[model samples]
Target: MRPRLHIPRPHRRGFLTAAAGLLGAAALGGCDRFAASPMGQRTLKLGEDANLFVQRLLLTPASLAKEFPDSEISPWFKPNGTIDPPDRAYKALAATRFEGFRLRVDGLVERPQDLSLSDLRALPARTQTTRHDCVEGWSAIGKWTGVPLSEVLQRAGLKPDARYIVFHCADTMEYAAGGEEEPETDTTANPGMEARPEGAENQASDSQAAGAEAPADEGDEAQGIPVRYYESIDLTDAYHPQTILAYDLNGQALPVSNGAPLRLRVERQLGYKQAKYIMRIEVTESLKRIGDGGGGYWEDRGYEWYAGI
Candidate 1:
């Protein structure tokens, strides 16, 4: 049986206090409306760039996120986005306990390869207990175990021009119903390096076509179109000692609700930056062509791309 960490308290008031202070400063200084205008967006972009520079400047290879003892692990680490992917391919993998899953690591890397779950576990691993601060203003602490991202990057061998590490995920955010077709099938549980779903492109165009918004009706959701979830980070965070592709949570094989198979644990960033249900890690020189041309799923929707905390 897999081991499970017994967390007495899910919320650490003390840690939350410290996290709040850190986040208040790191949080975007501008409001949504302020970021809506061309000039305002430019200003916010500059602010984001400045924040990235300062954070990177202060961060050292030796510097790490605060790690807690077993006693401090939150009994309940709230699962973020698409707790369980509804995609047919993902469900098939989950049904068989992901025995057929293969994590594709490609893009600008010189030696592209597909890593099995066993392949990842065979590598040197790191375990860290860190707090997860969310952009939604909540926090939780959890213990994570997995191979450091740098290990895989080194094994694959980065190309000289590689600039960013993009995580392609198995979770699809939008899918249209009725006669609309599902995403092209790949026999492997993990998705291959394909373009975003057509629905996702249309959604992007539609949203861009109209800036005005109607207040959301309770429980309303767009149906039938498929947009896969994805996120990215620069080589700096990818190589950070604390950065890992987590396969276990709180000493137990990660539950479906908590990103089974693999998920990113970039401890220094906000919760949204930790892309779950990860299927591929693409080393890229630019973020321009990925999902709405932003750095991440949330980032494309106006959340800051850096999201450092």
Candidate 2:
């Protein structure tokens, strides 16, 4: 059945906000040593599965997140996570107002594309005023404008085997030694997206568009390479009407602190799932090869992988 797209009613919106707050608190809290243990890990996984199952049962795949009117837009929308990326490539692009930036879409697709901001703007776009629920127990509403992720996927022509869409971003979570930052590198050597356009630099653009795991070591080796922020969603959510690559926020170009140039707005999920500074979109069959094999940067840190609300 095709998923229906409809704005959630006021009463239901209140219910969803409360429900999402409770879920985010329970799932995204700080991790302790217990969470790192094998037994505790299994227990957390069970909880995550229960949460996922319950949400799926309650909400249809096409269910739209509650949208608010412009009057209700938050006066101050707090930016969560890294506000500015320290990577050299990102800075270079930002220096030029992201003129040379391009969003690389590849992996498990018949046609890999490097879409510029103008290219994304030319595609069909959807705008919505929705609430952002951060796991830290804060909520805010803002208007967002961007291309539906489904449109981009259709343009790229997803392969039959594609099961998940992974978002590659520019924000570096961990820096190398001496505070030096490494340029963002595509996690995989997938031949499909390896080639860049002529004159394209190694960095990640603004039409508003939209890393590593290392072994522990006693010495400088512990620093490892810079690990950029990343998140993923199944094809179901990726195709949802509310899921978009947002380029504008609150009726203006998105601010850097708010994920300028581009960001992912997966409305049904918590804020952490909405990765900012998105540079590439990869359609993959599995998450095993990404970031400690845990699906996302936070997921590797013991957070729930499927944090649906």
**Candidate achieving the largest lDDT:** 2
What is the clash count for each candidate, in the order shown?
7, 3
TM-score of 1: 0.75
The superposed Cα distance between candidate 2 and the true structure at residue 57, in angstroms, equals 1.6
What lDDT would candidate 1 get against the real structure?
0.72
Superposed model 1: Cα runs more than 4 Å off: 1-34, 176-225
lDDT of the candidates, in the order given: 0.72, 0.74
| Candidate 2 per-residue C-alpha lDDT over 103-222 given as tens digits, one digit per residue, 9 for 90 to 100 | 999999889999999999899999999999877666778899999999998888878778889999987676445444345333321121224335533222110111333212212323
**Each model's TM-score, in the order given?**
0.75, 0.76
Query: lDDT tens string, model 1, 80-136?
Result: 555556677887898898999999999987789899999999999999999988776
- Cα lDDT for residue 257, model 2? 66
